[model samples]
Target chain A: MSGPDPERFDAFDARLKKAREQRQEAPERGAVDRSGMGTGLQAGIDVVAGVIGGLLIGWALDRWLGTSPVLLVVFLFLGAAAGTRNAFRTLQRLMEEGDRR
Target chain B: MASPLDQFIIKPIIPIEIAGADLSFTNSALWMAISVAAIYTLVMLGTRQAALVPGRLQSVVELSYEFVASMIRDNAGREGMKYFPIIFSLFMFILFGNMLGMIPGSFTFTSHIIVTFFMAACVFVTVTVIGFMKHGLHFLTLFTPPGAPKAIWPLLVPVEILSYCVRPISLSVRLFCNMLAGLTMMKVFATFAVALGIFGFAPLLIIIALTGLKILVAFLQAYIFTVLTCVYLHDSLHLH
Candidate 1:
């Protein structure tokens, strides 16, 4: 393989280096890089955390409603709905952004 | 009424009980087949008419291909491009499964631990095996930070090991629980919206909002899964 174009390489490197110098707050860059392991891991953490948190809320609601399995069952379904909804929105966003290009 | 979570209960068309386990053709499995058919039809029709300027069909197909390609490129780099087939298939499957599950009485496979666990475990095992295949037992060194003090090795190593072990569990539970909760909530609220018998829109509006949110969750969850796969591949290749 010949390797990436030198000009493109220089442009890419320059943007990254410049972004780093600016402390990563540009439109093309950000403080948080959602590029690798961290993004996915963080998402996993968030989802797990959200579910547990939601369960607590749901369980409490169940108690308030004077229903045993009701809240647990209802909120579990709600949580799944929320998760799937988020995933669909993300897909549309990605595709839309891709279309913009 | 029919149990708040009755919708999520995947009844099988062909109830096949071999010995003990409930191995039946569940609603989830049915929807999965439908999703696959949809994909097949879309791909076939989209690719059938190849044009230079590109029609709507061609554009849809091409854009999807490029979208996934760019995602893999950005996250997994050029080397990981080879896994595009697996990654794209996964993205589509999860995406379809999620969206279809949102259609009122449909079953969300991702809401099941067995399904999500299987998917996450595939990523975990694939990456681990890939890491070893690429870097040998040296991949174990991934647990140790690059510039950490030797004193912290014992502490960090065990923590890292535990975190790694929990990977599949976390991934599986997160998807499963989220779907389970969302579907059940929708059902309960819908029941209330109807049973209110007097003032209805209150629960109706809430469930509508929740359903909308569920659609967002579906895409986000799939993206999360795919990104994590890319990250794992990245770690396997880069070892950091």
Candidate 2:
């Protein structure tokens, strides 16, 4: 046979994309609950962890560099900012997942 | 009355010293061994028959397989299926640990930050290695969002790195905190039930409800952990 028609291949590609999207959009069975309690707990953990992680890293760096309180204060603010970013990203991901379901 | 936190005390069953390290077999280790054995037995019994018409054990095994498989497929796409063994093992281990700990007087190893942190760190290291392997130096670009302003790259990159580095902490802390809080609350309420005597039924009722909720949390936390692993794996494989 000669080369397959280009238009036909395009049509098939579109159909395939549509099918995949549909399969993804269908709500999965036995899905874990992501709303209410789960979301709240997850966001809280992300924020708290971000802050704690930043603080520890900052404290250790300060001790090693003999910078005393300077790096500690800067990292403390950075840690809070990171924590907020983490919480925002987590919520955004959950919201996108919620939309899909 | 005993303190509610007394249940978490790790007493050595067999003390062994190797060099400077204290490598003692403790209650926590015992419970972990038990959880592993239980999981192995369930899988062995479930698959021993390998029948066309499934028995109860086989059904449970098959259901768990399907659940994890679908979760991977959904979150990570087709390429992610290659890491099924690690993800499945994690799911079963945590699920088994949580469920077994529900039994009175049993230790909950997952409640310990060290254990959960170790697991999460392993995941973080594995995913990072895979990302670097797959994309080489380009993996560093993961810090930068697509189509972002170049001027803000310095500020944004550190924040991105901070968030990235915090994954293991958040992952471990989430499971640790949940197990710790739930088990502590249960113990405290049980203490209340005993102290109240006849009115023990009030706290008893609360404990009953909390038990059900705890079971749900056990499963949900396991699922959440596995799902997040898949998401991270997907990120490594396919960047943003």
Candidate 3:
């Protein structure tokens, strides 16, 4: 075949350049970009889930052993403490990831 | 119209009873099998031709491979690459399960807490085992936050242990709630679409938008699940 047309090649080069520029500008389009809102939500979930999990386990234990509210109260506080710690740890990790970027 | 929640009913596909334990293959099990098969086809057949320039199928396979690979690298480092198969499989299974559930009549396995919890428990157990295996009793140090006051060890240790224990619950709940909410929202909107008759177009538009969001959520949840697994793996491998 004859050599490729310069006009077609120029158009292709421009298109490729534009695509590259777009890709660079919007590199955070995928899962890599963890927004503040997403991080906050995840942290919130971690905390809440921790507390709920602890409460359930504590209540179940109390029911089995007939300890009334003692275990429930104790575990509830422990769960909250755990939840808070989890939230803090999650936030710390997210911050470190952000700093690395 | 059927209740939106009705879609999640786990009716047995092949009812089987052994010693009074229901070991029947249910809809959830069926869909799980389907998801596995779908992923196998996509990954195995899709990348069969290791071409210089990938076709559509090969591109998808490569993209998924790189996505999980980079995720593992970023969060867990090169050492974590050893568990790539497990993480990759988890991602694809959840991704496909969520996507497949969006089909009108299909069951959403991920939406069920039982299913999600089972998967999450597996990850938690595996991670914990790996940590113990690699570090033995030193893994207990994972609970001790560095630089914390020695006096507060009593308070900090329990909290750390509780949080560690809660990982499976949180992991499972996150995926379950997201899938459940998306499916519920779609069902409620579809109901409105039917009730509105000609004016159903408004709800239809919302449903379409919701479906797009659900798709995004599906992919994001899978990524989040995998990334969190990597994070836990990192913690296990390199305790602070």
Give one clash count per candidate, in the order shown: 43, 0, 0
Docking class of 2: medium
| DockQ per candidate, 2 decimals | 0.06, 0.55, 0.64
Q: Which ten residues in a row have the lowest lDDT in candidate 3 chain B?
A: B215-224
Whole-structure CA lDDT of model 2? 0.90
Q: What is the full ranking by lDDT, best candidate first? A: 2, 3, 1
Write candidate 1's Cα lDDT for B27-76 as tens digits.
87888898889777878899997878988988988987887787788778
**How are the candidates ranked when ordered by DockQ, highest leading?**
3, 2, 1
TM-score of chain B of 2: 0.98
How well docked is model 2, in DockQ terms?
Answer: 0.55
Candidate 2 Cα outliers beyond 4 Å, as residue runs: A1-30
User: What is the clash tally of candidate 2?
Assistant: 0
CA lDDT of each prediction against the hidden true structure: 0.73, 0.90, 0.90
Winning candidate number (TM-score): 2
lDDT of 2 by residue, B84-178 (tens): 99999999999999999899989999999999999999999999999999999999898898899999988888888888899999999999888
Instruction: List, residue by residue over A1-101, the lDDT tens digit for candidate 1.
Output: 58778998899999999989887554453112234443454454544534453466578878898887787775555554444333343345445545544
Which wins on lDDT, candidate 1 or candidate 3? 3
Q: What are the clashing pairs of model 2? A: none
Best by lDDT: 2
